[model samples]
Structure formats: C-alpha cells, structure tokens
Target chain A: MHVLRPLYVVLALAVIMLIARSFWVPNDFGTHEQGYTYGWYRQSNVEEWKNFTVKYRGKEFCGTCHAGQAQKLASAHHKDIECENCHGPALFHPADPLKLVLDRSRELCLRCHTSLFYPTSQRSQIKGINPDQHNLGLECTLCHKPHEASKPGRRNR
Target chain B: MNRRDFIKLAMKGTAVVVLAKGLDGIFRPSDVQALATPLRFVFLVDTYKCIGCGFCVKACKLENEIPFDADVSRTWVERYVVTSEGEVFADTPKEARNGFITGQIDLGRGKFKDIPREKIKKAFFVPKLCNQCEKPSCVQVCPVGATYQNADGVVLVDRKWCIGCGYCIMACPYGMRFFHPVHHVADKCNFCYHRINHGLRPACVQACPTGARQIGNIKDHGDPVENIIRTQQVAVHKPEYGTNPQVYYIGLGEEVR
Candidate 1:
C-alpha cells in the first residue's frame, strides 16, 4: 500500500497536466470566427514577414520606365490590374526590362474574353467572341492592341 | 467509508469536476456552425467562365509566397474536354504553369499535349481549392487538433502545432489538404485568411480576370453570393460525402471530378 503512493502521485500529476492543457489552449480552436488555433505550440515569429521582397512589383514599377505603354494601359479595361499579371514577374525588371516576353496569342485573349458554359447572368458582362465565328485563325493583336484592347476606336474587327 | 477510501473518492470527484469545468468552454457542440454572426463568407466558382488561364494559380502562389509546385499548390485549374463519343479527358498539368496557349512549352510529367479542338465536342475549366466544409473531415482527423474551422467558416491549419502526420491530408474528401514542401506541415487554402481579415478579397479572387471567382458574405441579403444562391442553380463538389462544402459552383459539368 505504501509503495503505491508514488504511482498515485504520478497519476494525479498527469491529470493536472491534462487540466492545465484544456485551459491553456484557445477557445476558438476549430470554432468559426475566432480563426485557427494551435495547442501548446510556439507562435510563428512573422515580424519581418510584413515587408518581404516580392516578385511582381505592380504597374507603377513598369509605368516608371515605359510611360507610353503604361499611359495606354491606364485607359484600357485592364487599368485596375497589374502589368506583371500578364507580362510575368518583374524581378530583373528595370535592369533588363526590354527582354519581357510579349504574349500575343489569340488563346491569351480567349482566356478572359471567350464565354463558355457558365450561367450568363453570373458571367462578366464583357462581350465575348465565339472563336469559330469571329476572327478565325487570326492573331488577336491584329485587330486589338494589348494596351487598348477594348477602346472604342482601336477595335479593327 | 474508510478514511483511505473516502480520500480516494474525493480526489477522483475533484479531478472530474475540474476537467469538466475546464473543457466545457473548448468542447462545446458546434451546432451554431452556420454563422453565429451576420458574416458568412461564401466562395462562388463559375466553371463556365474559367478559361484555364492559370492566373488565379499564379496569384495564389505569389500572395501566399508558396513555391509553385503542381502537387503542393493551394489552387489548380483542371481542363476537361469531352469527345463526341462521350469520352471525357481531364488533366491539370503543372496547374497550367505557363498558361495553356498554343506553342512551344514543356508540359512536364503529365504529358498534357493539347487535343485539337476539332476532335473535342466540349471543353471547360474548373478551378479547385479547399471546400472549407461545415463539418470538415480534415479537422476531425487532425490528431493534434492543428486543423480547425474558423468563425468565417474557413478551414485553416495552425502550422505551429502541426505534427506533419499527414492524417488531415488523407482525411480530406476533396483532396485539398497537402503537406507544405518547405514547412513540412499540412497546408491548404484558408480562403486567404490573412488578406480576407484585412477586408480584401482572396488572392485567387482578386487575380481572376474574367470575374470567374467571387467571394461574398452570404449572410448579407442581396449580396452577390446570396443572390446567386437564391436565384441560380449551384452545386457543391460532393454532397454525398456530407462535408457540406462552402464552395458553390455554377455550370459545373457532369464530367468534373
């Protein structure tokens, strides 16, 4: 009976640890709105995560150099979007900026402009062309310039 | 009772009481899972509108700083083309890393050589991500309780405590969860929790040029999410699994997996 005293103390300590854990963990774990939570884990030190170097430097970065194209893109449908969204990331941008790959494929235009099986009401109100009927086997840039794709007077076809 | 017996019973009773009191707050039933507040974030994916441009994929990779790997990406676009003979071919090669345009491009491993349009009867793109279920299996299977459904109804992984057990990865019915290549912990889309908390759209939604993706508070009446759910016919990926996925799809073809 006397020897069992240590075992009982160990069991009690284990129970206490379990109870402490229940209190230590956040209440919102797996619960909605409190956000995700972890139990007894070290927090990710993300103090420096706020201002890390990024690949895509936004439209302003490109606009600084190619003021002519930037000015034209500003008046187009893609005004709100970034230049790097289509042109790829501008990591070595200002140093060797002219080497940017120019994508003038019709498939690129169809990516956003071609309407398919989506409910018409839910689709973007922008007019889409049926590939087979409109400008078949022709480059999209032949009719529409990349900078001013939807501008009224610039449309050829 | 003897003195010893009385002491043992008292200790057991105290332990039980303390445990019940302590766990009561954490282990409450999630019956109010459908939004205790007026804010219910809903993700709408229009399969008809998606053109497999892979812009959303690139945006998510950049926004989350996730290394772009086909197997470990937060989101991927699937291209489904049905033949006139009723044969369906679906593939997501490198999550369309270079954008699915005609020309010289290495479509590594998956051998996703584009089938000519003349042989295809119909084709469309379906973008996939974590469904963020109401009763998420990933959350249930997480041994360490690392994965949890947040208040915004988004399922997220607490990377800090995750043991990299990969249990949640297997448990997810939609096959959304994956082990982060660098972190070695389970990772998946949380509807971009870091951005959405700041009152901005998720990276995928913001990057979609065709307006194929939209996220709105379903609780708000007349909101686009609510209006679509009320007026349009939307379907979830797998309702039979009973995951109750939050991602509602419009024009989801029968061929989509």
Candidate 2:
C-alpha cells in the first residue's frame, strides 16, 4: 500500500502535465516536418512571413502603366537599373498618392557618378565627374536626362 | 487473475503503447519528406564586382520600409583600407547608404581619422547581410520558439510570438539580428522572402548596378548562382564558428573577417 502511494502521485502529476500541455501549446505547434531538428514553432507563422506585402514591384509592374517611359529606359544606358531605384518604391502608386516621387537630388546622381579613384577596381570604368569642378550647385538633371543618359536635355518635369 | 497481476499486465501494455507513439513522432513521414524536390536557396556576393555604389543599401531600405536614418540596416557595405604598414581599417559610414567618398573615415563612437591615399596599399568594399546558416545559432537560442528556419532554409521570426527577449539577437554569431524600433521585435534579413517567392529578385539584388549580389535556388543545378557556388572559389565569414553560412563570397580578401 505504501509503494502504491508514490505511483498514484506520479500518475496524478502526469495527468496534470498532459492537461496543462494541451491548454498551453497551440494546436498548430509542431505541425512541421523535422520538428525535432527545427524547433517546433507554429506552422502558420510561415504563411504569415510569406504573405508580407512587397513594396518595390520591379520594372515589369511599372511597365504595365508607363509603357512609353519603360521602353525609353530599356534602350538607354540606365536600362540595367530598376525604375524604383531612382523614383522610389511605387507602393500602392496611382491609387494612394496618384504619383511616384522621384529623387532628382544632385546627391542621388553623385552616388555613382562621383569619381572614386580606385586604380585596380572596375568602378573606374563608369563615367564619373569631379562633383565640385563639374557643377557645384546645379542639379545633374538640368543637363543630363538620367533615363536617356545619351540624350542631354532639360527634363520636362 | 489476482488484482495485482491484472494491474501489472495493464501497465506493460500502456508502456508499449507510449513507446510506439514516441517512435512514430520520430519517424513519421511529413510533408517535406514526402515532397519530390526540396528547395535550397543560396546567395552569392562578388566582392570584386561590387563598386560600393550603396544603391543596394538604399533600395533595401525603401523596399523593406526601414527608416533611412535608422542606426541599423538589413544590409550594409564595409570599406576595408589595408595600409602599407599592414594595418587593416574597416568602416561603414551611414551604413554605406551614401556611398564611400574620399574623406575622413568615421569609425563609430566619435572616432574619426583619414587614411591617406598614399598610405593605403589596397582598398575594397564587402557587402554583408544575414548568412542564413544551415545550423543557425539564432534558431537554437530562441527560448520562445519564435525564430525558426523554413523548409527552404530561410530563417524567419514570428513577430507575433517573439517576446523581444533578444536571445536570438545575442546568439547570432554573425551579429545580424537587431531590435526593430517600430515592431519591438528581433529583426534580421530574410533574404527578402516576399519578393523571391513571387519569382522576382530581392530588392538589393535588383538594385545592384554592377551585379555584385546574386541569389538562386541551390537545389537547381541549372541556377547560375548555384553554378558559381559549385565551380568558383568562394568563402564565407567565420568558418571557425561552423554555422555553415549559405552566403558565399567571391574575391574575399584576407583582411576581411
């Protein structure tokens, strides 16, 4: 009778633990494959991460509405660059703001155009200018059309 | 049978049932195991080709909605200036969002000094992001089970579940994790999970003017990024830690850690 008392107590504790686990742990917990290796997290969290909204919708998304600008950009030297790189992310554009903001600051242009003298680097191949000597206060867009780099004219905008 | 004998028989049966259940949990064929093909994503960084334009950094900020002025960034470029006297100086001014220019280097904590051009033996830029290790220490140390690696090998954080304990942040050997100011959760790079799954390149990869950053499915032999990983001589940061980082770096300099 004395030995059975400890066994009954252990059985009661096991029942309590089972009930607590059922209430505390989420139903979807440990729902993934290899749960032993990859700590058992709620599987639904994977979908939560996957469903995150993407703000920068690439050039293809832009081409759907602005076909002319897209075509002009494709043939230009800046074709390799995405539209969002210069114009900012088109998050819900043409609906929320009705316009995408363009960063036409001289600093934006100088990021890649400023002459960085690296003798061994391929960066030297890029057409760069001494920002101070070229045009101190004037914006690069005043003379250079970024989308159409070869064509030098004041941007209409 | 006597009452004691009957109880003993029932106990033996229950033990066998519990052992079978435990074995089943260990060996059960889950969805990933049942799949014909599993995806493995890998990233490649060509340090030689990276011109330190900082466009990727800028693009990453805009795409991920990280504040431009924030002290932390998902990706950043480090400039290594190796002096003639064999001293290596590294710095990332403003997280390299405003490209590296010839000026005084702002080593963090109010330390600023200019490394004269003549004294520099070599200089180059190395861009870094979350390595998404095969056996990630961050995932191992998350006490709340909020950080986990997906089947595709991208480690992600459950923002809702994370208690902001910062354990994952500390456990990360690469120092990739950071506390998100707005969300108050531990945030690190997920390789732009939303974009890659939609058949589009990550914002940083697309914004790279010189094609320095590349990502692709390593499981696919046809992938260009995977081909480079297979044939090229590449290296990862801190192989001694044995994190098995998925990000491969080409033209990795000896000066870089």
What shift in Å separates residue B232 of candidate 1 from its native position after superposition? 0.4
lDDT of 1 by residue, A33-63 (tens): 3323322212231212223344555567688
| DockQ, every prediction | 0.18, 0.33
Clashes of 2: 0
Index of the highest-TM-score prediction: 2
> Over all chains combined, what TM-score does candidate 2 have?
0.85
Off by over 4 Å in 1: A2-6, A9-71, A77-81, A87-145, A150-157, B1-26, B32-35, B102-116
* Candidate 2 displacement at residue B165 in angstroms: 1.2
Candidate 2 chain A: worst-modelled 10 consecutive residues by lDDT:
A148-157
CA shift at B160, candidate 2, in angstroms?
1.1
Per-residue lDDT of candidate 1, residues B1-257 (tens digit): 99999999999999999888767645443432423667778899998777666778887887777887545688888777676688777777667654444311234563545455456677777899888887788887777766666556766676666899999889888888788888889988878776676655777787677778999888889797889987899999989998898899998888888
Q: Count the backbone clashes (under 3 Å) in each candidate.
A: 5, 0
Consecutive 10-residue window with the lowest summed lDDT within model 1 chain A: A38-47
Q: Which residue pairs in candidate 1 have backbone atoms (N, alpha carbon, C) closer than 3 angstroms, thus clashing?
A: A32-B150, A32-B151, A33-B150, A33-B151, A118-B48
